[model samples]
Target: MSDFVLTTPVVLTIFNRAHLAKRVFEEIRRAKPTKLYVIADGPRPNHPYDKERCLAARAVVEAVDWDCQVFKNYSDDNLGCGRRTASGLDWVFSMEEQAIIFDDDCLPHQTLFRFYQEMLDRYRGDDRIVSISGNNYRFSGQRLHYSYHFSRFPHLWGWATWRDVWQRYYDFKINLWPEIRDNNWLTDIFGLVQAEAGPSSEVFKTICRDEDIRYWSRKFNIIHKEMWNTWDYQFFFMCFLQNGLAVLPNVNLVSNIGFGDEATHTCSVTELANVPTEPMTFPVLHPPFMIADAFADAYMQLIFNRSC
Candidate 1:
């Protein structure tokens, strides 16, 4: 589709990875989004080389050659991932109603821009749908009748969302996590029975599902407690709170390529790192009904439980 033009706004969040940021920015350049917003975190004072690396990463956006309006929200002092991204996005949605988001590490396929644009238009007023995800964590394919399926989880590597979802659901402070955890509300939210973890095969399956609940429960505690800090958990908090669904494509559209010493969470190689993305063919088929694929979500839960 040579005539295809991207009109949606795009947001890029970058820290100190110049190389990875450049890779992501190049694809955005190709997509030629009409409006581009960049959010950059300042360098850590403790890290000796953070300033230079951060500056280099910020400069990558200066190479934008297309005719696009670019807005920048740069921090002079480090706000860390959680604060920087939350504050950055607050600035982004203030200017536009909806936009696709990317981290420095998330390399997007050309088709992702079109896919997200269509989803934004089709589901503009659908309050049940909170985000549009470009990630399919399963390396092995999950058979589906449509081009995409609804997901209970929010994958932030490369995703899109509207101002309503962002303003209403996203809790950077994770204020409600404690009440959910204390009252054991996740089971109700997930529609899962309160099955205890056991070893039997049928029970083992239930246990795995419970592990998914526990995995997020523990994560929320950590994020709220400041034991670990990042942006995704807070996004997920509102999704879980509202039982919101993210539209996940059948084919992977974004690849995480920043796995190295300089990386934060992706410090070591894992199956998720450098996941190869393939083009999603045209005339995307939307699912006839709006329902989360339980089989796919369960399978993903089993995979995610391995880390927990």
Candidate 2:
């Protein structure tokens, strides 16, 4: 892996967790990306120690020892998760055409960088492919013969995307939700006639409705508010609207360490907390057809619900 240096730029999003940021930064140091973009949100006004903690987290990024060009986008006012991450990524794509993104707590395996680079190059011009994800929640002993599979779900624990796809997110147009919902656009996207005839019809319907009958509904609504401001969800909506697919690894590559007392969204210790990571083989074997794996996605939803 030493010979394969990661040439893609990395965009890292961080808040106030300096300890988790340090742990994630160590992995980034190992990859040694050519350019590092650090996006840090400002501390909340109410928390007395938030300013100090936010500064500490930013300091972790300053410890880059390798020869790399570093860029920083620090916010002066707390923008919360929705605005902070969305605006930060907007800044990133404005400068970079494509980049691998990591949250402060998403610790990736060494091969994760390589995987993103490879997939990004392979599908750079393919508009049908929107993003490359580093998560595989299929812990039920299901395995793919190929290196990765296609899905509509854009898992952002650790992921990569291009500017073209990211531009589709329109935060101000959230009021059009009533129009979109009333038009039954989801049925068209999922091809409900066909999906309903399939074995996983119910699962497909649930995904199309954005109704995770599990535990994420309340949390998602709280963060999203109007449902268009949240960065990752907006990205997912873009992919679905474009009939796009996201590349998902056959094995888990990111271990989320943010679920704890300090986390904003991930405050509970669930099955996804600090999940283990594994190396991915080079020269990936692509799936024959670009289609969402329904069974795998259903299983993923189940696991997420259980965690919540």
Question: Which candidate achieves the best lDDT against the true structure?
Answer: 1
Model 1 per-residue lDDT at 226:
85
10 residues in a row with least lDDT, candidate 1: 200-209
Query: How well is each residue in 152-207 modelled by candidate 1, as lDDT tens digits?
Result: 87788999999989987788879888788888787677654544556763342222
lDDT of 2 by residue, 134-190 (tens): 988666655569999988788999899988777664353344444545676555654
Evaluate all candidate structures by whole-model CA lDDT and list the values in order.
Answer: 0.87, 0.81
Q: CA shift at 205, candidate 1, in angstroms?
A: 16
lDDT at residue 208 of model 2 (Cα atoms)? 48
The residue ranges of model 2 lying beyond 4 angstroms of the native Cα positions read: 169-175, 187-191, 194-229, 304-308
Task: Using TM-score, give the best candidate's number.
Answer: 1
